[model samples]
Target: MVSYTGAVTPGGPAQTRQAGCLTITKLAVDPKMSNNAYLLQCTETDELVLIDAAYDAPTLLSLIGDRSLTAVVTTHQHWDHHRALAEVVAATGATVVAGEPDAASITEQTGVAVDRTVTHGDRIAVGTCDLTVIALAGHTPGSIALFWAGSDGQGHLFTGDSLFPGGVGNTFGDAAAFESLITEVSRKIFDVYADDVWFYPGHGGDSTLGAERPHLAEWLERGW
Candidate 1:
C-alpha cells in the first residue's frame, strides 16, 4: 500500500494490525543508483532487518531508531544498494551481511566489516520468519535475493535488479552475466515460490511471482 503517515519520524511508514507476529515496513531511499532501499521490521520480537541502506548516515540512523532494528542485509553491492550501510552499522551495532563477492565492496565503501558472507541455500532467521538466500547475480557480481517464508504464507522475495515485473532488468551492459542472472531468477521463481508469491524488486512497486512467470518465455524469446 506504500502508506506514508508523517515525514518527521523518519524511516518507512509502519502499520501493525495483528500484534507480535508480523510487522513489515517498506522504506524508500534515494540509493544513488536506480532504485530505493527497504527496511523490514518484525515488531513482535523487536527484531528488524534492513534490505539495502541506500541513504545517508543520519537518515538511516533515524530510520533504524524509528523501527528498533536488529540487523542489516544487503541484496547486492551496487552503490545504490549500500550507500549508507556503514553509518547504520556503526550507529546500531548491527551485523551486516552480503553475498561473498559483495562483502569486499561493502567493506571498502562502508568501512564497516561484513560479519556474514552468504551464498546460495543460506538462511537468515529472524524470529519465526526466515529469509533464504538465493544467488541471482547478473546486475552485478554479487547480486542476490532473499526469500521470506513465514506464517503469512505469501512468500516474499527481494529481487535486487535482476528481475522486475512485466520486464526484466537491463542486460546489455553485461549481457552474458545478466542473462545468467535472469535465468537463475527464473529457476528460483519456478521452483521455490508459488504463483501467489510477492516479488519486491530493488526499484519498483510489488508484483507477484505467478504474475511474472509466464513472461519468462517472452524474456527468453527476446534473447534475454
Candidate 2:
C-alpha cells in the first residue's frame, strides 16, 4: 500500500494514514511557500493524476516513478501552484486540465496550453476512477475543486486554495469575494457532501466536512 502522510506544512512534520483503493500522497513541494502537490492514484490500475504541480519537478517525477501520470489537474491558475507545471508536463507528457475561464491565463503563465477545459459538474476520467469538477470561485474568478468518490463510498475533495481547515481561503480582504467563497462552499460542498467527506486543500493540512461544518457560523462571524 502507498503510505499517505497527513498534509504537510512549513512547521508541521509528516504523518501517514491509509485510505482504501484510492492512494493520496501529499508532498510539500516548497516548505517556505507551504505549497502542496498531491498525487492521486487508483491503486488497482496504477493510473495516477497529479494535482497542483507547485515546485520541484524532479522530486515530483521521482515520486510518480513508473506509474503513468495520465493527467495534471491545476485547481487554479495561480503561479505558486503551477511553478513546476511546465517542467512536469515536459517530463511526463501528462495532459493539462484547467478551469475553462482560467485556461488562457494558465497557458499564459505556464506556457503550456490546457488540453481540457473543465467546468463545474464536468467529469474527468482517470483509469477506473473519476473526478467531478466543482467550481468554487472567490479566491480567483475560476478557482475549482475536484471531488473523487472512492470505492469505499467515501469522498475526497481537492480544494485548491478555495477552502481550508480553519476558514475559507484568503480573498485579499474583498468582502464580496469572501461572501462568494462561503456561499459556494456551503451550497456546492457542505450541502452536497456528507460529514465524513475529507478535503485536501491547496496548502497546510487536510480537513473533513464534519469537522468544519459546525464552525461555519463562527467562520462567518469572524470574517476570515
Candidate 3:
C-alpha cells in the first residue's frame, strides 16, 4: 500500500512510498546542500540500487538494512552530491556506476573508482528491475537521469541536480550551460515523458512533470 507523507522540506526526514514492485525511499542527506539520496528496491528480488550518496553514510546504510545493494549510480560528478559516496561503496561493496564523461572526475573526487560507465539508452539492471539512463547535459557535462516504469503504470524519474521543481538546476551563471540544460530537458524529458511522470530531484521536494511543464517558456524568459 502506498502512503503519502507531508510535503518535503529542506533537510526533512526520509520519506518512503510503494509503487507496484518498486519501493522508493528519499532521504535528505545534507542540510546545507539539501542533497537527496534515493534507495530503490525491487520487491521481488529484494535487490536495490542507490542513486547519489550525498552525506551521512551510516544513516544511508542503516536505511538499507539487510537488503542487497547492487550498485551506486552517480548522476553527476558534483562534490555535494557524492560526498559520502566512498564510505557507502566501501561499506556495501556495491559497484559504482557513472557517466563516461564524468567518470574520471567522479573517481578523483570520491576516491572510489567507477566500475561502469553508462551513456544514453543504457539499461542498468537491479536484480529484477531495470532503470534506463537518459543523458542530461547542462547542470554538469555528465549529468544523467534514471527512468523507471513501474508495474502501477506510472513513470518515476531520478533527476540528480538537473531538473528541479521551479526550473532547471543552476548552471553556475553560465548562459550557454543554462541553454544546453534547458534544451536537453525540453527535448528529452518534457517531450518524451508524460505529465503524470513523477520525478525525485537531488535536493528538496518531489514534483511531477505536469507541475513544471507549463512554465517552460517562463523559465526560458527568466533564463534561470
Candidate 4:
C-alpha cells in the first residue's frame, strides 16, 4: 500500500506499488547500467511475472523468493536488457516471452530459447491478471511494451527502451527507425492512454504520460 513513486537506485531498495489486483515492484540493477527490472505479482494468487531480467541473477532470484514465476518477459533483445535471462530462467524454470522479431536474437545472444513469441494485442496471463503486449518496433526490430490496466482505473505501462520521459528510445541515427518508434509511441501509446497513466522505462525513474505529453511534439520536431 506504499505510494508508488517509481523511483529506484542501483543496488538500493526496491519501490513497490499496490494497484488494485496487482503488486508492482521496480528495482534498479547493474549499477553501471542503471537498468530497471519490474516484478508483477497478482495479488489474488501470488503468481509472478518478471519484466526484463536485465542483470544480477542472484538478486533477481532473491526478489522472487518462494514465489512462482510464471514467466520472464523480455521487452526487447538488447544485450543489457537480458543479461541475467538465462540464469534466471534456469533457476526459476519460468517461461520466456519476447517479441517475435527479436526472440531469435535474444536466444542467439543469451543461449536461452524464447518459450513464447508475442506481438501487439497479445495478452500474457499472470495468474488471474493479464498484460497486453504493445509492440513499439523501432529501437529494435521487436521492441515491446507491456500494459496493465488496473482495476483502479489507472494504466501502468512498461516501456522497454522504446519510450522514455524526455523522448523515445535511441534509434542510433536511423531516421526510419526513429520514425517508426515515434509514430508507434504516439498512436499506440500517447493517443490511446490518458494523462494519468504511469510509465516505467527500461532505465531510470518512472514518469506519467501527462508529464511527458507536452514534449512529444518537441521530440518529434527535433527528430531524436
Candidate 5:
C-alpha cells in the first residue's frame, strides 16, 4: 500500500526536481514504553530508512522486498524502539545507526555490527536528502533528531521523543538527565532549525517549529 511517505524541504534534491518530499509510512507497533517506529521514503529517490523498530519483527521484515535501505536509525535504545531491531537487521543486513550509550546495547541486541553512532552535527545521506543527526539526550543518554532540509522553504524534523506539539517530550524516562536534555534540544535542534520547520514527532500527528517554539519558555519556567 502507498503511504504518506514524507514532508518536503526547500532546496532538497527531490523538491528541486518537483519530486515529492520524504514519504513517511507509519507501522503500528507496541510501544512497550510509549515509543514508536516509522519508515521514511525519499520521494525523489525512493530510498527507504526505518526510524525505529518498536513493533513486531516479522511484519517489519515482510515490508522489505529486496529494497536497498540506506540505514536503520534508532532515535534511542529503549525497549519499545528496539523490540524489533533484530528482525530489521537480520532482514535487510542494513546499517544499524544510533546514538551514544545505546550503541553498545544496540550492538548487543542485534548481535551485528553497528553501521554508525549518530551524534551532534553528524549527517547521513539518504536518497536525495541529508538527515542531520541533532543530539537531544534528555530522553536517553544519546537521543538524536533527524533534521531534513525542505524545498517548500520549511524544513522537516523527525524528533524521536525530544519535542512534541504542545510541549517538548517527556523527560521522565530519564529524570536525572531531563534538565540537560532541555538545554541540548535548545542548543542543537531549536537553534539550528527555524520556527517554520515541520516537526514529525515520535507519537503524535504533526506540528511546526513555530508552534513548538513558544513552549520553550514553559520548559525553562519549569526549570526544563
Candidate 6:
C-alpha cells in the first residue's frame, strides 16, 4: 500500500492509495484542461467504478487494463468532466450514471445516454464498497459529490466541480448559483463530515474537509 498524496499532473503517472477495503486511483487527464478521472476499485471484489471519464481515453483505458469497470459516474454535466465519456463507454460497455438534473444535458453534449440518474442519498456500489451520492447543486443544476465512509476513521469524498480545495466551484458570477453551492457545501458537506475526510476534486490535487472548512466564511464573504 503506497502513500496516497492525491497529487497528479497531466501526463504523469497516477497515484494509487489503499483506503480501507477500497483501492483508489487518481489520475490527472487532458493535458490542457488538467481534468482528473478517478478509478475506485473494491479490493475484495476487484469491481471498479470510474469517476468522471474526463479525458485521454488511452491513458484511462491503460489504467483500467484487465479490471472490471462496473460503471462510469459523471459528477456533473460539465464538458471538461466528460470528454472521454463516449469513447470510454464505447470501449468498455460500462453503465453510465449521472445526476438526474444534468443527465439529459450530459447526454445531449456527449451523445451517450446515462444509464442511471442519481439524486441525494442514492448509493452506487463499487463491488463490496458503496459510494453515497451527495448532491451539491450550484456549479450546475445537478453537480454532485460521492461520499465513501471507509471503515477507517477518515472518509473519502469525490467532489466534482461543485467543491474544491480553496473554495467552492465556479458559479460564473451568478450570486444565486454561488449561494446555492456554498450553502449546500456548508450544510451537506462541512456540517455532516468531520475534518479528517479526504476530498478529491474535479481538477488539481485533493484536500481534506478540515483544511477547507475554515475558509467557508471567507469564501461566502468574497462571493466568487
lDDT of 4 at 110: 100
TM-score of each: 0.84, 0.92, 0.95, 0.98, 0.81, 0.98
Give the winner by lDDT: 2 or 6.
Answer: 6
Q: Rate the local accuracy (lDDT) of all candidates.
A: 0.70, 0.86, 0.88, 0.94, 0.70, 0.93
Residue lDDT tens for model 4, 1-224: 55768789888989998877888999999989999999999999999999999999999999999899999999999999999999999999999999999999999999999999999999998889999999998999999999999898999999999988899999999999999999999999999999999999999988999999999989998886
Q: How much lDDT does candidate 6 score?
A: 0.93
How many clashes (backbone N, Cα, C below 3 Å) per candidate?
0, 1, 0, 0, 12, 0
Cα lDDT tens digits for candidate 6, 1-224? 55779889999888998788888899998778899899999999999999999998889999999888989999999899998999999989999999999999999999999999999999999999889999999999999899997786669999998888999999999999999999999999999999999999999989999999989999999988
lDDT of 2 at 157: 91
| Index of the highest-lDDT prediction | 4
Worst 10 residues of 5 by lDDT: 10-19
Q: State the lDDT of candidate 5 residue by residue for 1-224, as single tens digits.
A: 32343433212211111214766555555434434456777777778888887667776666655677778898876666777777777777777899866698767766656678877888877788778888887787778888877667667788888887776667765556767777887887788778877777666456887877878878766743
* Least well predicted 10-residue stretch by lDDT in candidate 1: 5-14
The Cα error of candidate 4 at residue 176, in Å, is 0.3
- Please give the distance, in angstroms, between residue 185's alpha carbon in candidate 2 and its true position after superposition: 0.4
For model 4, name the residue pairs that clash. Answer: none
By the TM-score metric, which is better: model 1 or model 6?
A: 6
- Report the C-alpha displacement of residue 46, candidate 1, in angstroms: 0.8
Q: Listing every candidate in turn, what is its Cα RMSD in Å to the true structure after a full C-alpha superposition?
A: 3.8, 2.2, 1.6, 0.9, 5.9, 0.9
TM-score computed on alpha carbons, candidate 4: 0.98
For candidate 3, write residues 1-224 as lDDT tens digits.
33654244444567788867788888877657778888989999999999998888888899888889989999999998888899998898999999888999999988899999999999998778889999988999999999999887899999998898899999988999999999999999999999999999888778999999999999999986
lDDT of 2 at 120: 95
lDDT of 1 at 5: 29
Quick one: RMSD of model 4? 0.9
By TM-score rank, best first, the candidates go 4, 6, 3, 2, 1, 5
Cα distance off (Å), candidate 2, residue 177: 1.4
